[model samples]
Target: MRLRRRTFLQGTAAATAAGLYAPAVLAQAKFKVAGIHASPVENAWNSRLHGAMQEAAAEGKIDYVFSEGVSGTDYGRAMRDYCEQGVDLVVGEAYAVESEAREIAGQYPDVGFLMGSSSGPAGENFGTFGTWNHEAAYLAGMLAAPMSQSGVFGAVGAIPIPEVNMLINGFRAGVTRVRPDAKHLIGFIGTFFDPPKAREAGLAQIDAGADILFGERIGTADAAKERGIKAIGSLIDYTPRYPETVFANAMWYFSPLLMAAVADKQAGTPTGRDYTPYCLMKEGGNDIEFAPDMVPEDAIGPMEEVRAAIKAGTFEVPVDMSEPT
Candidate 1:
């Protein structure tokens, strides 16, 4: 239930030791798979993608390769490299370089490409998927709303894109769910990897009366801990690092769905569909977890109640992001 720091070398070593780095299997496998990312391998979001790949490769003789630290000018080259490598399935999150990826995908007809982007599947062999993380963020906001002493919650985000906007909007909705008059102080750091900027934004929000903070990227929790405010983590749990300050976290499980798609592709299914997979309460894709060290025992019941409502279709979390008049 907490974020564990891992180095890219460590992850690569583990994968290699587990037979994932086998070049023979990769070269002659019935289906070769590759993952590319704009974020570094050490990042929590990218780590989850790595974890998913490791899990999916467990049952089959699939060849697995990865490209990371890819962005802007380098994205096309990376995509082309995978295509030229004769990889059967290529998966990645193209945040800033979506257009570049689309262009590259257009050039590779035999290769199946899946990207986590705000854009469409576009090309014949390309597909797109994004996290329906707003639902989980809203739940985290609801939990933070009552816990805040200042009656103001803060959200530190990356890039202000639709992906990030939904999360911020969801947090705001959750806060309003519990405290109708709650005020949110939001900040955008423009880049996903800049933990220092995220930390600064969090600090600014804390200084502006925000007693509960939402950390969309890596460093916001450090700022929250320093300021003695409760922090809600995104994408992964961070309670292990900031046990006292982190109240809860929202987790996105991307592997199961990706593997399911891989199975479909292996079975000769068509690859042109725009598959937007979601992790709702029923699907077990998204989660709101409380820090064992911080959250009170009595709060679990209400949280489960809300979760059940979401699962049973009784409670719907609104995801619209239009500003209020």
Candidate 2:
């Protein structure tokens, strides 16, 4: 009888150890996270946002509500919809609906608001964050300058905003570092999702002696591929689609950053600041990736050297975007 009782107690103990009877088990339920994008998932930036959400979900059960391709009036409505649904966190890119989001956040003070933006939030209930994407852009420019046979580079930008301008300036800096005389031809597409317009601008730059291109919009890389020029991709790597044409890509990892914010808010230490979370080689925020199949084997060694130097603080690439064009 004692042995039987011991066995039963051991079983109970094992179950308790496995959290089968913990009251907090039910209390620690999965939270819902909603992401509202300024553009569709077909674009790299939005796709990365979705990817981050998925990654967070895999770690813990997270229900994701995505409102993709939303802008202006629709964006505000979408925020309201997420709040009405009683989601724990509403994550969105605030570049398009900054003011509208701020107004909506004012109404739903309980809901946590996190934005991927260059601008900051006006209230304590909201927080804004963006990656220091300029570092990756500069690295991409470094790759392009040496590989460009035409001695010219091109950038297809979405808008003239500071975010886009910084990337253009970073790319120019990278090229200038290696090839100081290299000329950069830039085009602003005005809209982030306009693929045809972005393509046209890319082609025009190519015609103007830009043999190497950095693509920002949805179809900019496609334009570079069609023109038989090498392209550096932004936000996410597109080398899988155009192995030969895409030389390198600047990748963004937004999942960990967003999850950190959500966890902080849940812990009651919410940061009410509009800050650019620039990821460098040390922080693992942003990094450059080369096409495994297309990039020349000999170039990899030197690139790794530069990457390591940057990470080690020995090689500081000039990041000043205010330099005169």
Candidate 3:
């Protein structure tokens, strides 16, 4: 979903128009939540967070507010500002500013800090979660493997961080399961949101004989659109935007994780825990989306069966965190 960027809420009137702050529910007002996005809300990662917050706000669960396009250096300032605003829970990424974020959380013991992090929870308020969408990524690979005529696929990612590494590794494993001899080309553009660089990497891989590209970043689909090749999207479905190019997507829903944190805050319990499990396929945190007409008939049955097996707890997608070469 494309979300319009929301500038940070300013002053005491930080609540949305119909937020819990209104006297209408002062007697049973819900917790106040604030999101501090390191990237644009429209980005794959931030969109999930923003969407969940939007959904919660629509349901009148809490008074929700957020700020997008917050740079890494400014992350701490954002966190402090939200905490000082009397927000009960704060959501954002702590990958680049872990120490500063941790210190801030320590300062505010009452606020719940649910951050997208590679590390574990710190203190009593800071909780962490990784983008655990590998199960769906594996499913994506199972369907995508058969489409590569060159027996070589390309993966364009932001960086080889643990979460990114694990997802790509799962996809690669699924590709191998389908085509034992299938090879892959991997590229990292160093930054998370540079679409042009991702596209360039995808184009380079296409030139190197890759028939299908896994767009772990935004612009890979653009290369596929230009080359008229197949692609798989990461985090969110790009099929609507790149209908002809993106056949499948590894989708992530941040609601399960956020609501759990919210529950803790309401219950007066610490939210400091690893929230990775909430993103598992069984928890409705992650799943796969594929266009039936685009999937090969032969690949469809197996993919569906695998998906069922995963949700049934019979099949487990192995998590491999090693960086791909």
Candidate 4:
């Protein structure tokens, strides 16, 4: 579906207005959850987290609050503020301030911290998670391979980090799996939220003979739309926004991880474990979004088989962290 950036919630005000913070039962009112986001809520990554919290709040499972635009220097402070406010669970990404966030968690032994980071579990209360949606991306790549007429694919990403790299590599592997001689043109905008830069990179790639694009960044869809080319989306579903251009997406569902974290907090257990497994395809953490009109009818059955293999644990989508040039 299409995600409207403007409707995205910011923090406390947004949560309450959306009626996403009411307690389901009297006993469930004790658990409070807060998210500290370094990026705007509209960002695909953060939006996944925000959407999950909203779902939880709507179910009266947790009292959810969030803070957006949290910088590296202020991340620790934001976590501390939530903890001080008696929030039971604090969620965020610590890619820029890993040490500071872990230190804050150490100071608050009772509060649970689930963050997105490249690191592993730290203290008794601190844990990290990744989107781990490479399988879905690989599926997207398989779909994109046959649709590409130029035999060249392009991908524009937020950064060259492992999380982004894995998806790119997965997509690449899918493309090569189908079109053994296909060439990939990749670019990184260097920042997570720069649509203009993503578009520029996409345009450059298109100029260099790419008929399809892996839009790991925001503006790639726009570029594809302008050029009348096919696109595969990542992290979030963009079919609603670019129904005519984007045919498939590798979507990350943060709800599974969020629910697991809440369960741990309710059980009086610390959430200091790598929750990446909760983000796997089998855990309902990730999936591929297909636009039927844009997909070839002949490819449908095979894609479903691939998805079945993944969910049945009969197939494994490799996790490649190597940078895609």
Candidate 5:
């Protein structure tokens, strides 16, 4: 759902009615939000954050300003700059400069720091969130299993981090769900934005008889398109660019996380907590999208069943952080 100001405020009011916060908290609806992104706006991860903030700003929930392409060495300075500028909420990913970012956040108790970190939040004012899309990746894997023509699948990831590893492992498990005999060919491009390197790695997988590819990075879809094979998307939907070659996608929606952070800040409770619940499947954080013409007709029914099971809490997709071989 599009998180307009009205809907967000309504949700906040409903939460207050449920006693999550006092009724007076609704007065703090508007916030001055600033983002310090480590990557460019075109990068999928950063794009999600920037896009959601833009939507919130359009709705008048926040007066948003952001800085992109921030280097790891300068992340703390950028964050401090925002705090010094009297920004109420500072949002960004601190995966590379986790300790430094958290330390800077400690300096500003009045500012709400919602950062993307591999660990939990720090200090009284620092909070954290992540994509947490492993379950959705597993769902994508279930779709990929029966779609594989060569009985071999490949995944091209940006790195071997826990977040990346969980997606790959989840996809592998999903593939095993339907095609237990399926073989996985995995490769990491070492960086998030290198399409050429990702393409090279994906092409090598295709050469090894892998017909279905997981484009965890941006450029793996190019390899799949070149091979005329179906591919899976990550973080955001890529079907518009590769409508025929891309079948299923694991999408990480940022609106829910951002909206939750706003509500917490309004209620004066946004601090020292991990906001990952907003990124879970149950909270509309992560999801899978299937193209009707691309996915096998028979596979769609079971995939829906798995999706429903996930939301209903009948099934749990385990998170595996070990590097995929």
Candidate 6:
């Protein structure tokens, strides 16, 4: 009876240890994040979010899954499915399904929702952010001003949405800062992922004597490359793809914002806050990149002055969301 009692005690202790170990292991499981893209992952805007999530996952920060080519009409459904799957956070563009997305967030109050939106946050978890790359776009335009041989710059945008307008306006504002008489020809393709339409609009602008094309959309570089003129790229670097055609790029980095959201989730204090400030230059959200050999030597100094001022919080890039006519 003594030996049996000792054996039973040892067995009970081992089972208790096993139970505790299992719980500890489960507690260390990575957070699951899901992204739903309105366009392909390769698209300009989605790529930023996709790349950020990829980087985070690679660094063992979170377990990330994404579904691309989700349309506006299907956005709410995607959100619901992901929420039902018990994802910790959902990230995507919510400009189209703002109302529906907010309603879904209300249903899943435990899960955090962060999206690219023009409006404010909703409830406790529906956070919103902007594309706030206007500062970088301004620098891109400054670089393009000297390259414009015809004194005419062309900007091709996905839509006349507030953020889109703000970005284009920033670029034009930078250009006119240098060349006061510079004329701009602008067009909106009415869709976000239609590169062919963007290219067509760019071609029209080029035909109208637009010497430097500001490609807020992807295919504008094709027009610039074909026309043998300089162009400015948005969201991603097109210089590698277009060689000498794309001289500068207005880049938006989403990693800082993602990490912030992850931190909030880990702290269990996630809130429906506007994360737009995380998209600013000082916050490592956006910046400009240019091929040193492509940009004129004279344009570098002024652009750097503005860049420095932006980082130093002295010079402010105006956010003009009014429709750019």
TM-score of every candidate = 0.85, 0.83, 0.91, 0.90, 0.89, 0.89
Error of 3 at 265 (Å): 1.4
Over the stretch 57-131, how does candidate 3's per-residue lDDT look in tens digits?
899887788999998989999998887767889999998898899999999997899998878899888999988
CA shift of 177, model 4, Å:
1.8
Model 1 spans with C-alpha error above 4 angstroms = 1-30, 59-61, 323-325
**Candidate numbers, best lDDT first, in rank order:** 3, 6, 4, 5, 1, 2
In the range 57-166, model 6's lDDT, one tens digit per residue, is: 99988888889999888889999988777788999988788888899999999899888887899888988898889999999998888888899999999879888899
Candidates 3 and 6 compared: the better one by TM-score is 3
Candidate 5 lDDT by residue in tens digits, 68-119: 9999988888998877767788999888998888888888988898889998
Q: For each of the candidates, give the backbone clash count.
A: 1, 1, 0, 1, 0, 0
Give the winner by lDDT: 3
Model 4 per-residue lDDT tens digits across residues 199-279: 999999999999899999999989999999988899899999998999999999999999898899888888999999998
> Positional deviation of 164 in candidate 3, in angstroms?
0.9
The whole-model C-alpha lDDT of candidate 3 against the native structure comes to 0.90
Q: How close to the true structure is residue 252 of candidate 2, measured as C-alpha lDDT? A: 70
Of candidates 5 and 3, the better by TM-score: 3
Superposed model 2: Cα runs more than 4 Å off: 1-28, 296-298, 313-317, 320-325
The digit string of per-residue lDDT tens for model 2 on 86-174 reads 77788887777777778888898777887876677667778887656777777777777778888988888887767667777877887
State the weakest 10-residue window (summed lDDT) of model 2.
19-28
Locate the minimum summed-lDDT window of 10 residues in model 4.
Answer: 19-28
What tens digits encode model 1's per-residue C-alpha lDDT throughout 215-309?
Answer: 98889999989977789888887888888888888877776557655776777675655656545556666778776546555555666788789
Instruction: Please provide the root mean square deviation of candidate 2 (C-alpha atoms, Å).
Output: 9.5
